[model samples]
Target: MVTGRVARITDFGAFIQFENGEVGLVHISQIAHSYVRNVSDYLQEGQTIEVKVLGRDEKGRLDLSIKELQDAPEEMPRPRMIGRQSPEFENKLRSFLRDAKERGPGEKGGKKRKK
Candidate 1:
């Protein structure tokens, strides 16, 4: 963990300068545990914040994260499955398939009827 001052804010993330004069980037996704719509909402131009050093990027630039220093929120419950449908729905689907088959190839609604 290190203390850094937010040097600049961009559309994608914010740039921070460490005490040793090293610079790093705190990406929008690492701003918070929840969704972040705007970077300004969570950070300012000169705000001093504690950040975790996730690692260096492919280009050797420092990758920092604020959310990593904070506790994560609880996981949301998964949605329930719809499961099987009613008999009426199954019957309707079968009837529709039968009608489509009866209308075979080159039929009025199925395809252009040959003269």
Candidate 2:
């Protein structure tokens, strides 16, 4: 683990400078385990942070991750269906499917056929 100061914030990620003058990039996905809509919300310019070195990329640039040092959040519960649908709803769905099959392909609703 090495200490680095955020040098710049961009749409993709943040650039960090180490004590030895080496710089690395902490990708937006590496910033946190959760969804990151904006990089600025998680990091700022000149903010000092501890990062784990993930080694160099194909271009030999340093690859770092802050999320690797932090514990992951608990898994969210999956949503499940609670009850069966009503008879009326089932009837409507069946009717709709029958109408759709009758319409065939590329046929728009309420469109009249040319002679």
Candidate 3:
């Protein structure tokens, strides 16, 4: 297993600088099983991720994988949308907006006045 803080994330891959000063590219294809069109969805600069060393390529560069940590499992459950706010909540929101507008700029409301 290779461990390192992500140096940077790019559409093509993440650049990881190892402790020994060697840097490696963890290609987007290897970040996850799901389609990864944007590498930012899976990684961020300074974020640490564990990678498994698959093998060295013909050029003697390391090939890394993030998916080796797991076996294929059942599809993830879809997130449920919560219920809408009640009428009472809407009434409160309207009151708040009206009050804020009434206060106007330079008042207690959240508006900045020209100096």
Candidate 4:
């Protein structure tokens, strides 16, 4: 991991410079685990942050993700699985499809037949 100061901010990402005079880009996608709508929301110009090196891109510029240097994210709670594939579900779906088909032509809440 390298510690660097944010050099500049752009619509795409933030530029940072390390102690050894090497500069790298921390792309918006790599700045955090959550959706980053804007680069300035999570980072400020001149902020010091640690980033893990992900090697270089095609242009020889260093690619990094600040999220990698941070601690592992907390596990989110999984939704309760009530075993979705029950025989009852299949029967209900089949009946609904059949009824929707029979009532047809914009009246059964199904698609209207293309003219």
Candidate 5:
């Protein structure tokens, strides 16, 4: 873990300057395990923080994460969906189509008795 002072802040993330003059970016998602509205809400300029190295980006710049040092929150269970149609539904649909076809257009009621 490297200890660094907040060098800069942006809507996206914060930049930190390490002791050896190395600077790295900590993305907003890596700042905390909870929803963060602003980077300053968690980190202030000149404030020091401990961050774990998350390897480097394609440009060789260091990538860091503060959430990595903390315990992860438990995932909530999702409700089961019981909305599948039964195989017999196909037969019911066919029956309904056949009945509608038997009932010709302009026919309001089920049947009209012969006068």
Candidate 6:
């Protein structure tokens, strides 16, 4: 369990300063549903939000979550917004894919063939 005061709000998420002198990030997507455009839309600096100890990483930093504070059950992840279009949507995506393909396979480029 951890207690903290909200320190700042940014496009990505909110930063909280724990009483024990540690900081944690509560990502905007994790804040709530309905597409959070800004973290300030739901939380502000100096506000207090309860967090559950999710787990710590190899660095020994605490990983906290706020979903525990909500009364309802968890919401399923949403699907991708693929079909949306623009004047050059398909062309832009084609260019992106081409660039990615040109970048080559994972890790260092070039592949070895069995002789």
Model 1 lDDT tens row, 1-115: 8999999999899999988999999999999988899999999999999999999989999999999999887885567889999999999999878877877865657443556
Give me the candidate number with maximum TM-score: 2
Clashing pairs in model 3, backbone N/Cα/C closer than 3 A: none
- lDDT by residue for model 4 (61-93), tens: 999889887766697556788767789989999
lDDT for model 6, on a 0 to 1 scale?
0.74
Model 4 residue pairs with clashes: none
Question: Compared to the true structure, candidate 3 yields what TM-score?
Answer: 0.59
lDDT of 5 by residue, 40-93 (tens): 999999999999999999999999999999888897456788896887997898
Compute the lDDT for candidate 4. 0.86
Error of 1 at 47 (Å): 0.4
> lDDT score, residue 112, model 2?
38
Model 3 misplaced regions, further than 4 Å: 75-115
Per-prediction TM-score = 0.70, 0.72, 0.59, 0.63, 0.64, 0.54
Error of 5 at 7 (Å): 0.4
Summarize candidate 2's per-residue lDDT along 16-101 as a digit string, tens digits: 99999999999999999887889999988989999999999999999999999998888855578779899999999998888778
The candidate, 4 or 5, that scores higher on lDDT is 5
lDDT of each: 0.91, 0.91, 0.81, 0.86, 0.89, 0.74
lDDT of 3 by residue, 4-115 (tens): 7799888799888778977778888888877788999888899888888877889978777887776755886567899989999999999888878877755863554455
Global local distance difference test of model 5: 0.89
Task: Give the Å error, residue 80, model 4.
Answer: 15
